[model samples]
Target: MSGIEYHVSLVGNDSWEGTRSAPLRTISAAAEMALPGDVITVHEGTYRERINPPCGGESDDNRIVYQAAVGEKVEIKGSEIITNWEKVQGDVWKVILPNSFFKGFNPYANLIQGDWFTPKGRDHHTGAIYLNGNWLVEAAEFNDVIHHEGNTMLWFATVDEQNTMIWANFGNSNPNEELVEINVRQSVFYPKQSGINYITVRGFTMRHAATPWAPPTAEQVALIGTNWSKGWIIENNVISHSRCTGISLGKYGDEWDNAETTTEAYHRTIDRALGNGWNKEQIGHHIVRGNTISHCEMAGIAGSLGACFSVITENIIHDIHVQRSFTGEEMAAIKFHGAIDTLVSNNRIYRSVIGLWFDWMTQGTRVSRNLLYDNYTSDLFVEVNHGPFMVDHNLCLSTDSKDMLLNVSQGGAYVHNLFMGAVSILPDLGRSTPYLRAHSTEIAGHHTLECGDDRLYNNLVIAQKDQNGLSKYDSAAFPVFMDGNVFLNGAKPCIHETAPLEADWFDPSIKFVIEEDSVYLHLTCQMDWKNQKSRKLVTTELLDQTQISKLPYEDTDGKQFRLDTDYLGVARDESNPYPGPFEMIGEGRMVIKVWPHA
Candidate 1:
């Protein structure tokens, strides 16, 4: 097929031929006419309607490209501008809109509800009010907006069957003079159907979406989503102010998503996914990079379709899931389920509920070279997965000892990481988690007991005062291998196997360097493992030998692990490499390419 370039402008007519001079009016109009190998260049304007593409491209090379024209500031908004307003006493203002203004869907009437969504005992709409490009807090009650003494607040109520009434506190500014908008749509750019493959959306600012909570058990919704699609490249975009999720590379669950209320619903959803083509040919080979996704209620990037054989790198994701009017198990900056053979690298994630959460069936996955700090919960939470996985070269710092790392499952190798907080490996024996077959996405079986066979190698751990650098629960029965790790500032890691045991003291003759803000330990003597020789120095070769032989760190279609270089594009040494992420450039020194707030 011959490639064609389509143009869209604010002043053009939709009936015109989408040429350089005769451009279309709406992105939706261009999307309706776009075919494979088509490029839709949207001009600089605030487009309000959602761009629901009818179809996508046939392959990656012939993708349907939707990009901002050159360096133009193109904004695709899920909101519509509202101008008519009346002062309703004090700082509160009111606006009444006819029912015809909403077309068919009303986001104000659609309450945010889904699996694990908490409305705080009041109905919270997906709709929001933005005053001069800044989003206002949505009030659950009318009294909270009108009677409250705060900076600003907004509330919406249905006025009979003909109109909708909205009240907001404008803080002395007249509503007529400000650019006020309200969320009227669910998504700015999203496909109405699934399997929309090989699409590229770039260089656009998407915001003010009324998205719902995205759980692996439900039909995940986002401001912009690749709904069970393949080969989508969402890059170089600024996505913000989503009511729930920002970007979703996820599945479309069935009616069970709305009916089932237990954990078995997720298992059933997985079963349904297998019946449908949830294999390498059908699901997840997406590349999401160079995007800044922030101020989302749930997550910056979330997927339930496992994101199998995908690459999510170099994205700046922050301020996610921070305001917790609602809480659940699936809240994080980047959360995914069944991330088989996927690479999550070189991303900066901070100031979120949890940083990176790899929940269930995370086999053959690697979390490497990421900078995570100032998260409320732990930076990394790997729950219920027996992995032959790797976490290396990450700089994980938290404000306190409670927010470092939480490893709930087993069979993980930690190498060359800087941990500036606490680490906990607690196994929940009452729950049995499922494991998938090696090299396949099919579930093999479930482990009835907690199998903790995690290995920590050459990591630099700096613990806070009066806190154990690394510790496990007392009742944990599995074995954890520890060797070549440096604990600074008189910090000792505790290991428990059938009984609790503190780490043996290092030789006092070895000179160590402890800085004011950081600690660098130079060990001249090995750890004193007198009677614990059987449990000490257990390498990655022992823990992951069987799984590695079977799986070999390959994607479903035999794509090898994509870690030839570190996060900063530095080449890694094949033989005798150093402990952490960076290869040492000189004697007694390593380079950290990406620093906090750099």
Candidate 2:
């Protein structure tokens, strides 16, 4: 009683806290009484309630934190035994970012702060946490970890139908929205229903993907810069099993076409008032890294809304499949709609309709050191748009057809990559067809540079499917600098230096195993040239018959692999392991073990 400031025991019926044994009964009472630097300890138990408070003032620092005792452990748990209808309001909900947790909660009540429904199976229209200056880390305790097998489950009880969990609005059409910064980390956040901004979420896991809460005319998840939520960092998170995009940054408002154009076109339009629409000049800096996101119904990680000066690196994103239930468009993995000054590096993507699909935008992207494998349609699908991009040191593998690696126009640099795809082409397409230039440009008398200022060097292009083992396709105008590649049957230069290594695996039977106890695997292949590499890096392996493999391989220590297995997985490190040919490759490999079903 002398040193203890206050205590709240949900189990006790006492409303007063005069004695050490007679503590406050409710957490709400303890929060009101807590002053700055005051400690409020919650005993281990289940407290069913929804929590909301006003935004934090600058002068107030009376942080209400829920933590384990120095030697004793306490648990605040969600009730897993209740039905979705019964689990409403009581699963420990909060309005702002409060340091709280359930040490023993298995299926706690839904954490709603924004526009969401409640557990009574009613549309409660409440969000989980308001996320102002407050910081929230819904961490798992030793018991919770053991109960969940050591990973935070963003959403449980796989609803046979689709569902949404987290919804946010970054304030409509307010340029000053960037001033508000919110960081949501080390937890699992799901059901991001609408557009948001100025929020940085890292080391989190997301699931139960739903359609963007925009009009059918709006094809994107959310418009990023309508009200500039600048300085957003969506890094080191596992965003998976969603129906739409993994992460969409940098977009503007509605333009000419209303309905389908907005719903279907994930392009960056230049709003005259907004200064070149959604370019690097408008949006602030962004960093999206070390995430493993897959099973999206649409594109994996897309950047439209004119996101500028952004770096999307070291993420494992794939399995963007189109479902019949998805009545919209086919799914794409990594799309650069109207982005600029972007560096998309060190990612592994596979099993999607389109991988690295670039559309209309001024090009200044440095897309290098990525591994793309078995992209169902094409690995690099460039459209009518053009740029001054630098495509170097990437690996592309098992592209099913002859349309995998190419540009709609010859602009960006194509250097040092390993590309493997089908080689059989009919004269209907013709030999003079250019690989770097699109068919629309090739058929024209003399096409202007789609977006010139290009350079090519040290790139390897291989044809894994040609019976004659030819790497080069017959084209009228070959891409510049087609020197360092090798063809399978000595036909033309298709793939680069390690033609045999790529050709040997061209039949598509080789696989990199990621055992259940195996943590994660840093599977990298390097070519002979200065910065050359094999492109197709796939994460389709199944570990322990239950868990699936994705990308960014989490943190590594030499051969040890630590995947971003769950929502709260990505941890920062001082060094990077995969630095390129001249640099170190898989130097620090860490192992990650996940028992999802256990």
Q: Which segments of model 1 are wrong by more than 4 Å?
A: 152-156, 449-451, 473-475, 494-543, 546-579, 584-598
Residue 60 of model 2 has an lDDT of 17
Local distance difference test, per candidate?
A: 0.75, 0.39
Please give, for residues 45-117, the per-residue lDDT of candidate 1 as tens digits: 8888888888899987888999999989999999988988988999889999887788877877887777766
Worst 10 residues of 2 by lDDT: 542-551
lDDT of model 1 at position 205: 95
Report RMSD (Å) for each prediction in the order shown: 5.4, 16.5
> For this target, which candidate reaches the highest lDDT against the unseen true structure?
1
lDDT of 2 by residue, 1-598 (tens): 1223566676554468723488777555655565434455656554433212111111213222322234333322111111122222312221122123223221123332111111233221101122232111222232221233322221122111223222122222121332222212212221122222333344433443222422212334421111233445565555654434456653433453232343123221233323433333335356677777775544676655334566777777777754323322324677665445567777777777777876544244567667677677778765533334556556666447446664554444454454556433221221111111111111112223322222333333444444333333324142332333433322244343233223343222223344652223232333322232432211212111100110111111112122212111233121321222112223233222211111
The candidate 1 region of ten consecutive residues with least summed lDDT is: 529-538
Candidate 2 matches the true fold with a TM-score of 0.50
